[model samples]
Target: MTIPAATASFHGIWPALLTPLKPDLGIDLHRFGLHARALVHAKGCGGVVPFGTTGEGPSFSVDERRDAVDALVGEGVPASQILVSTSCAALPDTLALTRHALAIGAHGCLMMPPFFLKGVSDQGVIDCYRQVIDGAADDRLRLYLYHIPQVSGVGLSRKVVETLKRLYPQTIVGIKDSSGDTAHTLALADAFNETLMVTAGHEPDLPELARRGSTGAVSGLANFMPHVVQRLAGRPDAPNTPHDVSRVRLLLAMLGPYALTPALKGIMAALSGEPGWLRVRAPLVALTTDQMHTLQHALKPIALDVDVD
Candidate 1:
């Protein structure tokens, strides 16, 4: 299947970056920019996604998010290589962030449906997205619909995706399936991989999705194991597929026992040797000392190389 010209540039491994915070829980822009640049330059990621689920998007206010994006761009990570997560509980906030991303020349914006409410009708979901597109009113906008039903309490349905694509083909360029269900991820690839860039958030599904012509991921695992994910998504024929898959599964298993954001931060702390990575914003606490110790022990056996400085 041929990828649409509009979505062609959105392929490859784009790590959903782990935002580092100061001890006061404010965003550490210096650390954040350095990490994003490292992922793209040193780790060979296609790009970096800021304020994603792994980065604790909803935890920060609109101002905080905007400042961080500006700082990242100011620090010399090309704006065109950054995909900003503009999802917010409110339509206005989402619009503001989306516009800001476009203003900065970001590669695209990744947005989820209005997740504050549950069991919303498909039309309602469609309308919410419609308003965002119409509200932003930017021809430069390239949007990737986010689908993570487990965390957001809402999921983007096929009908919703179809309707949005029909209404805004140029703007609605792709879908990020973080569903974690292999069947659903594959089905999405089967249905829309030709027209839209269908990306799996789950690392294990990357090889199969790549087989189906889906060429990229907005991956949490890519934060730490980018080369592994790059190989999985872009080099399925590489001899290391089995070993990479096993390593990803093992790392994900370590995250299973704790709050994912904090646990990933814990791993980042161990890798970078910066305890500042362990700090999380309010409503998400840092991993306990015991949890961190256990994570260290589990990761010691894996012996992942520290690629990011």
Candidate 2:
């Protein structure tokens, strides 16, 4: 489970990415790679992850993830540039995933806290990470802690990063601040300025973060909207940057709230010309006909290319 010394850099605009699938619900690893290659080859996309929350990461089996990584890397994307999110429910599973990712030559892996229990203490969260880092035995295993407190319930508390950094400076590495808390991220930027790369998960906040010496984002919008991601990412520190950010927010507004997920899946389906692209895994329903009608009304005009024709 040792991450090679040669593979430690995790940077830039990595779309949390999605796993394209056949209508039959079979894993379309080939189509997945096609999407990956397209993103990797795109102007602003740094790399991709096959099984993120956006990728329906929880819904995939271990074998599917392994094959997905292989397929993407084989398509000419380098191993280091492709960061695999190994965020699972249990410690053993997380360790296995971490090791598997290391074996497949993923540059780094992301981890989510054990979400089965609510109101977890920071120590428990710390122990979970410590166990993963220790078990992997990979000094070069760059671990980006997923900080979506809303979903995970267990926030990786303010002290956790410092403790992890001290214990495993090279291995613990950075964080994906999806907490959406502007003040929290701002504090992190102020405190851990040079220590770790703090990525602003929200695009609207990127310009402000970039000004504060924060790194880029790990955005879902980028999965389907790569060109937009590039434009927003490259908005730069200048007077007119707010205008660009507002334009993106306007797009997000037009796209709607929950529309992001289905619409994103729709984008892949449309692009692949596989209209029966996928149905969200059971317990998670796909958009109804009326809902899709709403999507059609919303996306096409934005030049989002949601048509499968």
Clashes of each: 0, 0
TM-score of each: 0.98, 0.89
Per-model C-alpha lDDT, please? 0.89, 0.72
lDDT of candidate 1 over 194-222, digit per residue (tens): 88999888998899888899878889878
Please give the distance, in angstroms, between residue 131's alpha carbon in candidate 2 and its true position after superposition: 0.6
Model 2 — which ten-residue stretch has the worst lDDT?
A: 1-10
Q: List model 2 lDDT by residue over 109-214, tens digit each.
A: 8887877788888888899899999999976588877888876788888888898888888786677788778888878877775777777667787766666665
Please list the residue runs of candidate 2 whose C-alpha ends up more than 4 Å from where it truly belongs after superposition: 1-8, 238-240, 254-260, 270-273, 300-309
- The TM-score of candidate 2 is 0.89
Top-TM-score candidate index:
1
Clashes of 2: 0
